[model samples]
Target: MIPDPTVRLIGWAVTRTAEAIVDRAADRIATKMKTCIVMTVRHRAVAALPKRGRV
Candidate 1:
């Protein structure tokens, strides 16, 4: 059986690594979402504007 200290050390390392990866991924996803939302809003606003000098 593995020693208690060794197991604790492994668990701690794994937890820290996972947390780091998740944090990085969350930041990237948030950035992309914000960009997409802003672009979509701008596009809709421009499209909704009335046409000028048209029959």
Candidate 2:
């Protein structure tokens, strides 16, 4: 069977495009997770701190 270079190139491009989309989604998810974690930690810390004494 004769291999067609154009078909192979097209397949590679499609695969790379799919991979880029997946990578972007993963990055967004990771960023959201990190933001949530940071917010939760800050809330907990603030809640745990003692009230400031009057001057």
The digit string of per-residue lDDT tens for model 2 on 1-55 reads 5479988998999999999999999999999999999999999999999999899
Candidate 1 Cα lDDT to native: 0.99
TM-score of 1: 0.72
Q: Which stretches of candidate 2 lie over 4 Å from their true place?
A: 1-3, 53-55
Q: In candidate 1, what are the lDDT values of residues 1-55, reduced to their tens digit?
A: 9999999999999999999999999999999999999999999999999978868
State how far residue 39 of model 1 sits from its true place (Å): 0.4
What are the C-alpha RMSDs, in order, of all predicted structures? 2.4, 2.6
The collision pairs in model 2 are none
Return the top candidate by lDDT: 1
